[model samples]
Target: MKSVHLTEGRPLAVILRFTLPLFLGNMFMQLYNLVDTVIVGRFLGENALAAVGSTGTIIFLVQGLATGLTTGFTVLTAQHFGAMDPKGTRRSASNALMLSFGVILILTFFSTLFMHRILLIMNTPAEIYDDAYRYIIVICAGLFSIVLYTLGSSLLTAVGNSRLPLVFLMVGAVCNIALDLLFIPGFGMGTEGAAYATVISQVIAALVAAVYIGRKMPDLRPYRDFWRLDRGMAIRQIRVGVPMALQFGITASGTMVLQTAVNTFGPTAVAAFTAASKMSTLLTQGFAALGQSMAAYGGQNYGAARPDRIRSGVKAAMQIDVAYAALISILILLLLHPLMRLFFPAGTDTGKLMEFARPYIYFSMSCYIPLGMIFIFRNIMQGCGYGFLPMMGGVVELVARVIPAAVSMRLGSYLLAAACDASAWLTAGLFTAFAYHFYVIGRIEQRIRRGRARMDASPPAPKKE
Candidate 1:
């Protein structure tokens, strides 16, 4: 049991070891999403699938916020782990858990209370509103499990241990798929059944991860020293977490705006967008897993004061991301229709809707490298305890989505909805590029300069001479 996942002294090995499990874990998580849709579409019909689709934006918003908090926890854990301070790591982990639980509770309460209102505001179709409301409410009610799982997993990833979480997620995903089949098809529970299955799976993941950490990861077990809340640590965690939360919230709000634009085009467009987005997510998971690897690798090394190794890790990540994105983009473009049909099925309006969505899918796929670069850069910044620039990237995404969406709706063209997405990626790419150069690269240079200055300012060793 090596204490830190990153041996700053060997950056590539650390990244590969940490990333492999994260990649598999993310794939399993995506399977959870795919299975939910498959169960709903196959068993409950298209309308039930639409109902689940209706709540996607809202769920992203809430889940994104929870994940942002988890990012803060990861940052703290990564830094402490890098510095070889187990006590500090434990304290940060405890505070992050407390903070995450509290935040999820508030989000769950309000989201459930305003479920109907939010759906209405999103212009969710009248036919699907009731089912959507039910689905969202159930999901919201189980927010604690979602938050806990994310928190625990982030802690593990932060400490360079992605395998434990990956194993637990695999178990949970299998259980979720079984439950989805049992509830939706066997029990005829429909959309509510899918939501219930998801929550149940999340709960299982959280419990399993928690037990594993408590038993295996001595650094994470809550002791009396860790139990005591330090005001300074709490403040630092919040300071880092809040902006990341806002970034996700803002980004999710833009997705809602895009959702509203899609809604105006009717259910066909909504269904198409939903299906396409799901496929895109599955593809992006490959790059995202790599990016997560970079975060842990970079953060630990940055903490360990190995700036050159951090730079090398980011470079390796960029190359991996670019190559992977290029391959994936080609595959997506070549197999668009067949792939879409698999998710949407034939002899249905979904297949036709997917045809309308082909252009959007192809265009978005072309930008995968840039999109991946953004993730790599953002995660590197996050690993280095810098959150504001990435938060600014969120602002860029929000404006790009909102303004284009508004214009497109006014123009009465659903095509603009896809355009807005591409534009947002382009805009976010610019910000990510700038941050990579100015913040990450610049910081590295500054550290080097300061080191030189200290040497120059040092007094002569005259006594030795």
Candidate 2:
């Protein structure tokens, strides 16, 4: 009901405003994971930290696939809304709920089936394997809650009501933290408690958002027609969603390989990689927010046949993301010591873990520019419905991620782990730049020129002079 129309506005100001709530919301989401990390690390100890860390790649594999698939629904919702087609927007929104359910439902059944094998594939250390298994089990069972929240937040964002989701997200995150303190030390559930904390919090967020959206947003409200299946919408969703899912799956697979490489060094490397990864994710919340902004911005203009707005939006996103990258890099470097303290306590053994993990955060922070570029370009193009080149770039990133991690293993686990991330971001950024500039941007320009041509050929204007 409080949706913002992004079709005509000051590009940067509107995008920044829209992104602010989304940014804070994302940090809250990431903070949910951080709460797990910090609590598990403190209560269950560093090895416990490694157990949760070990599950990162596989969990991301699932989440990434879910996100990629559900993203189409977001784009479609935004497109219809931007075109001012309430009927189509409602139809798409209703269908999006179904689509979201279909994908995550299947994943929930299949992930639990393959959970152990997935861990095995990651080459999880024997010391932490059981711990990792228990944690992932709870998480896998409750993944639908996450899917529900992701779908709801995405739909709300599409309609330009990012603030509402942020409010609910904070509520969920606060619940998670309280539950973490209650479950872990209070109840002695250890790492499993942390997992339950995460799942329950996510469930709360999902249910709250769903109920509110059903009551408030006309496009998402359920009715008799909402139950009817639309073959055309379903088909369009698959055609778009499948490629996006593949790109995500492919990229995540590369990270899985890199994770396997990290596992080779035993629990210390896994724990370190985990801490670095949490920082990397949290630090780049701004960039992720910028990318999401571009996705919504590009989608709306494209739907309205105003392709000329896209280039300007892209330029603005690039500028914002680059600034974000620079700032995150500096802050991480400046606060490296205190930041590391969040996950590891002060001690000789903990200090060893810090040595292994802290470099990862520093190196990753330094490389934010390329990583930010990757997200911004890929997401905006995906929003514009340009799937092929973006999908191909995933393959480029896959090769980049794996080869370096594998080849650099001889240099030691830390370098090998950092190499995987650095190469993946750098390679993916280059590939996306080529696709975005030569293909995505070019087509939008062509469309804009043609739109202008039609305008010029229309009836002549009367001159007041």
Candidate 3:
């Protein structure tokens, strides 16, 4: 029942402490992909690497839904916990688990059944198509493991226990690396081996998290009559969860469109895009963590009916985000060459690869501030129960991204395509920020004014009668 209540203390210090664990956890989550890319690229060669890389956006398309759903579900748990209502927290947690089961089945079924067609739709290169099919199918089939883990970790995070998830993720990541080495080299399982390793590791993490919750965090455990459904409760969760999931799905669709454009350029370009993107993902974990911190922080404060704290938390978080973005931007620019080298073999001709990838890495790193803003405002707004606005931001991003990528294709300019992400981030960040100001900020102010008015109107007690 010991939870890190973010409803009190200095905003900066508390956010920093919360964000550090979340940051490391985010990096470890990204580590799963980094290890796969490194092992596949180095040991299996370019075609196998490109094959795995090509599945990135599609994987995001599926996993993103799981992430968004879990995140949205837990926002309620965070709120209940913040309001010091254990019964509400437990009920919400149970409903989230039940909801996750239905989603897992549906996602796994569709992703597996239409695996080949999804790849075909993405315009996957014929040479690498078979390998891509094999790799993605395993991930799709084991989609339940990923969803289960996401739900567990998100619940823990909801109650302000980001550290435990990080520990569990570390265990899973290490196990994943060992399995990747064994299956890929020791047993010659090829690209699919990497997929198996990832799924198995996720199962391990999910199981560990469940056991820990059972033993330590009894308050977070499902109700005794877990099967009983509360229609109103489920409806409320769906109201929040569905829009958040759609936001992720919409954003991912844009990436999928961009990936298809990259695919049209052939496997070599695909590999370059993959390598650069892995690095970009790795470097941005800090920003992602800040966004997560804001969600938990905002939710808890909102539940505690402290709009003032939420405002201050956002200010502190933005400061941290801007500073970190500036530092990481400089570091990535300096280390771009060496980092890019890790994705390819020593003797391979990397000139052509860098030719395509350099622009992407450079452009993305240059726009880190906008990217960071997108994470911060969108998440904090969702935490404040304004899900639809963020989803609208995602639609803006989709339009911005798709238009540039398609135009780049028409002009046969990969460089212009590389600018797509920057444009999307800039547009989405602006949209979300404006939404927060126009909608969320006003709402918070109204709540604050009502609380003040209620206090002013209260009957005064007789003085020391």
Candidate 4:
């Protein structure tokens, strides 16, 4: 029953309230990942670390599908909520749950079946191939938990209850860290240990969220009769969800190609990249959180037929994102070495690691502004029920990233390979921004005009006195 209704408040305050929990939750998730990397690099050594890192894109490819689809599913739910249609909201949520579960099952089956082949295709080094296989296989087998957690959290966020999900994530992060220490060092489970820890933590979070929704959020619970598929509803969600899923897949596919290129440089480059990527991910959490807030904000306003408010929210969000990006970029560059040092042990030689990773870190920080804008516009458009354009933007990004990495491979330059992400963010940002401005915003303005016209044409009320 408790939710932040974005349709009623100051846009900036509402969005920031929504974003704070998301930002903190994301930071915790990143910290957990950072700890995992640190533990592996220090305890198991660089080859073990590289093995885990090599699987990042493959993991993203699978997990991103779940995230993207679930996100798409929730957009309709958010809209229904904003329209104050309880039945519509519950129906949308039910269908989303069923669809997401089905897709996750298929993904898990294929991913686990071909884990070794995927690693091989990524050009995983001979020394770390077996370890990578071990890690990713466990992760793939447990994809169900990830789906459950993502779907549940997304459902809650859709209704503007971001705080509970953050609490669940914090609990999961703590559990994950505890398990990581116990399994890796105490039980000597190696990379598989890290994988197990992650999966178990997700399971815990998912179960807790499910229980909470069942007991506390009766508004979201669909009746037994609502379980049956509604073809029209399914179509609506799929219309929005599938392109979003493909966007994640396509974007991840590009990262896979780039990862393959990185692997060719051998284990050291891979490890350095892994560390740098983790750091960049940490710094960008603010943007990601802000973007998510906009999706909910835009969705609710759109359903309420308040297109003008959506515009105002996007502008406010962009201003926040830009300022955060600027500040974080400067801070990251300042602390690059100190932060990079945390990935390894107290006395490990980081000379080679720094040499390979520093330039990549610099590129990431320098391009934060564009990257932040990419999240803002892309998510807002998706919230507005325009998935195809964002997916096309992802295609542009795929091309931008893959081309540079491929050229880097031919030229034998890691710097060139490192530049791929910056280029992708820039190109994709421009594409998304243009699409929003030229197409989506124009459509939104038409909605606003119609709303105003309807009001203007209405008959005046008689005086009560």
Taken over the whole model, the C-alpha lDDT of each candidate is 0.81, 0.83, 0.88, 0.89
Per-model TM-score versus the true fold: 0.93, 0.94, 0.96, 0.96
Better TM-score candidate (2, 4): 4
* Poorest lDDT segment (10 consecutive residues) of candidate 4: 340-349
Error of 4 at 422 (Å): 0.5
Residue pairs in clash, model 1: none
Once fitted onto the true fold, the runs of candidate 2 whose alpha carbons sit more than 4 angstroms away are 346-350, 410-413, 445-465
Task: Name the weakest run of 10 consecutive residues (lDDT summed) in model 3.
Answer: 222-231
Instruction: List model 2 lDDT by residue over 21-101, tens digit each.
Output: 989999998998898898898778879999998888888888888887887667888888888888888888788788888
Q: 17 in model 3: Cα distance from truth in Å?
A: 0.5
Comparing candidate 2 with candidate 3, which one achieves the higher lDDT?
Answer: 3
Stretches of model 1 off by over 4 angstroms after superposition: 1-4, 9-13, 344-346, 349-351, 444-465
Give RMSD (Å) of candidate 2 vs. truth: 3.6
Clashes found in each candidate (C-alpha, N, C closer than 3 A): 0, 0, 0, 0
After superposing candidate 3 on the true structure, give the runs of residues whose Cα lies further than 4 Å from its correct spot: 448-465
**For this target, which candidate reaches the highest lDDT against the unseen true structure?**
4
- After superposition on all C-alphas, the RMSD of every candidate to the true structure, in Å, is 3.2, 3.6, 2.6, 2.7
lDDT of 4: 0.89
**Which pairs of residues collide in model 4?**
none
